[model samples]
Target: MAKRLLFIFMVFILGDIYFFQAFTTVFHTPFLHNAYWCIDLSLLIGVATLIFFQRQGKDIQRQAGDLITFFLIVFIPKLVALPILLTEDLLRMARGFPPRNIYLSEFVLICAALIVLVIAFGLTRGRHYYRVRKEILSFPDLPDAFDGFKITQISDIHSGSLSDVDGVRKGIALANAQNSDLLLFTGDLVNNKAAEMEAWISDFTLLKAPFGKFSVLGNHDYGDYTRWDNAELKASNLDRLKEIHQEMGFKLLLNESIKIQNKGASIALIGVENWGKGGFHQYGDLGKATSALPAESFKILMSHDPSHWDRVTLTHDQHVHLTLAGHTHGMQFGIELFGFKWSPIQYFYEQWAGLYQKQGKYLYVNRGFGYHGLKGRIGVWPEITVITLKKSVS
Candidate 1:
């Protein structure tokens, strides 16, 4: 068992190395020029701490202290990240975008990912729950048809890393404050197993949307990253996670459709299994999923991958009007300050975060509510998107 765990750990660490090398090759220049350098320092601290953790005795308390520090290491960079995202001045005044080929922006995304690796290392070492950061996302102009659409969106929760339901109550409170019209969870509900949510099953029930609550799957939800000797067991775990969703007042939408109707005005919510350019998520079949929607009316897709908007969705399909995604997690890093948007993850995801429109189609890539791999949220604090369906006013 230990050997398997170690092998998994090595695989992840090596993947990080490859990511860094590939990123540098593309950008070929120093990152961000100024603020980007901080991540470089964070990386150095990460390397030194990793070696320290490996050498430490397996004593639980000593290990616990290390876990806390691991959280800190992951958490601090986000303070830098927050300034870049929320502060109006920082983003607007910031100069330069990532160079196209080898874009330095990607490096920023890669560095953001490193924080997760560090946290996952802690979890692999039996560490969990360093801290849970609470974030509120209030969107502009919620449609009158859906006024007070207090939708609670929890994305990239990565439940396996959660030691306990630390911020669960606070998060619920935040969600309730908006008097949410609906609650939409954008995927990554569990890190790996269905059992992980056991500790906090009751907590999620606290979140109730007047209309209803819904959930989708994330990359980690499939448990593909782990080596499962029995495919049946893996499949069973997924089924169980669905059961958990049902238990928590959520309707798990897997390549299915639902109707949100109020005062006779209705919008169709179409959910397909995760779909990405590569085989990241393969179950999304728009043809089959949208079969429920009539030839007309608006349809919003809850697909985990943003690429689906470009690769498969934006056709004259007419059935799909909006795509809501969250897998990129804004690379969980970057600055949106000073009226300038900068994040390395953007190169891979043109619609990495916030509202985007193209070819008359629309997409809202959420920043996510819960932090993944890492313990803290930086520039792109987890978001709860409130989308208002506006008339073209044409």
Candidate 2:
């Protein structure tokens, strides 16, 4: 880890040095040049400080997130402009050391400036810019009574990182406005501590549905990321988090299944604990959750990570008609416009955002309800997903 970080630091420094030439060319003022170096030095020092504190075993999760945000805001624009500046330099070298291309340097600066404005908006307004994504899923085996069952799902609250009460209230209010038949929260309710959710209990409790609200834990709920004085303390923290879920009017499901009945017909709702691939803990038992159900039961499974859908749920003996998850948070940054969508998180999670189907089973990965490591969202806004299940004609 240390070696990788060192390599990254060296790359950052080299990139800054190369990009600074363009900065100097675009602006001839001595004051601006001094200001540029000052910001660069400050960021480098900040990185060093974070590394030192981390090695000392201090819990700097929040600080680390802030630093990452700063790095993106400062470096992404430079990265975008690097290729253009490098091309200009190569052309000049081929032409026998001619004068620098002032026009190209100016253009690169303009592009970088525009990117800064976009990043600024993401840091300020994008964090709370909630978007509602609706999908209509058709299942042939869906019960007639559940032909139009609407489900509202929000995931990865990470309440510890939330600071704006009004912003949170807006999201909760929006979720309630959907007026779905069932409400589900695929979790990360807090960031490693139960106390993070104390203030938001009332806001979340307002999320209503005609059927009921149910939830399943995510990887972050286990309190494994942070240090605890003892095992009992960590256990107690998780216990308290479970109680918070109940207080928020959500039935916390831990590897359990329940039947939701309407008009004398029913569909199964199964929720398992946080089970993820790539070193994530395997606490969920799919067989135990569906032990009492018949093979042909119309089931909607709630698992926190979408990887579960591919790794286990798809191949399980009993088929799951639909699965809802929200762990990737769409990497809190990406471009989604004009029917095109892309995010860094996609490489890590096959089913990162939106709807995915395989072998006739459906999985919808929510972007997330709250921010985490980056402190703000860019193109991938916070999400409130509403899925309508319809009975498909055979």
Candidate 3:
């Protein structure tokens, strides 16, 4: 792991050096050009520190995420500006015009301005811009008692990645303010160990719903990504994570079915362990989870990964009315504007975020309450999904 991180740090350094060299040639001032190198060196040191802490078995997700944000803020503008500037210079040559140094200087200044703006936004607004996405879903077979049942679902609260505890507390308070009938946490309460959530337990316990609070394990909850001292230690971590859910007043469902009642009417809610496509572990047993429920009963599934919905749940003999998941986190970045929503993860996972319906079955993939890897969200703001279930009058 250390070697891999070192390789990545080297690659980033080399890439930045290549890009900064272009600026050096454009400026033609030796001392001013050296200033750029100083900045690059400082950023490289930041990356090195992140890697060093990671190697020393420390949780530095927030620090690492900030470094990534800084890298993007600096590099992306140059990547775009340089291409456009070069293309314009080529067009000028074709028109019998000589390449002008002034034009290059202007382009550089514009690129610098853009970099400043990006950094300002990422640091000030990117992390705290939480959105409450309200979605209304209708089902034909939904019972009358559940017609107006409101569910607020949150997922992927990677507490270890959080740098601002106060901001996170506000997000949790927002979820509580919704006052929905039921609160469902799909998965990923922490990044790795159960201890990651120790500090935030009191904050999250404030999240309450009239019906009840229910949760399931996310891929990160198992601590599979980290190496432990022994097998027993790893097992103990997972067991403690389960107990943490109970302490938070949440019923942890592990390949089981529970009945939720309202106005003398009930629906079967099934939760399976993490079952994801690709390299993600497939510990979830859909058959075992729904085995005890009556075939004719209305059912809802709480799964961490959305890939399991179409691949396993829909194909199963027992039909599930709805599946709630949140593994994708919309890749923590994307463009959702002008009536269009897209993320690179879409190419890999068909159901990456938001709502999807096929042949009357529904899937709602929450954008996630917290974040991972890159730390701060870009275009894809952090989300708290409020879904209202309505009986179809049609």
Extract clashing residue pairs from model 2.
none
Q: What is the lDDT of candidate 1?
A: 0.64
Tens digit of per-residue lDDT, candidate 1, span 1-394: 4676576456544444434444455455664343344654665575566567566632233334445455445444453333333332344346443323344335445666786565455334322212222233232322346543334455666666555455556556666665657778888887667887887788888887888988888877887765567999999988899898999998989888888987767777877788887558577788888876786766778888888888888873654666778898776656667668777578667888877777656777877656555454445555656553444332
Q: Score each candidate by Cα lDDT.
A: 0.64, 0.91, 0.84
Which candidate model has the greater TM-score, 1 or 2? 2
**Candidate 3 residue-wise lDDT, 46-136, digit = tens:** 9789879888998775677678777767655665565555665687788886645565656666776776685566555667678899989
RMSD of 3: 4.1
Model 1 spans > 4 angstroms off:
1-152, 391-394
Best by lDDT: 2
Query: Residue 367's C-alpha lDDT in candidate 1?
Result: 76
Ranking by TM-score: 2, 3, 1
- What is the TM-score (0 to 1) of candidate 3? 0.84
Q: lDDT for model 3, please.
A: 0.84
Please, what is the TM-score per model? 0.65, 0.93, 0.84
Ten residues in a row with the worst lDDT in model 3? 13-22
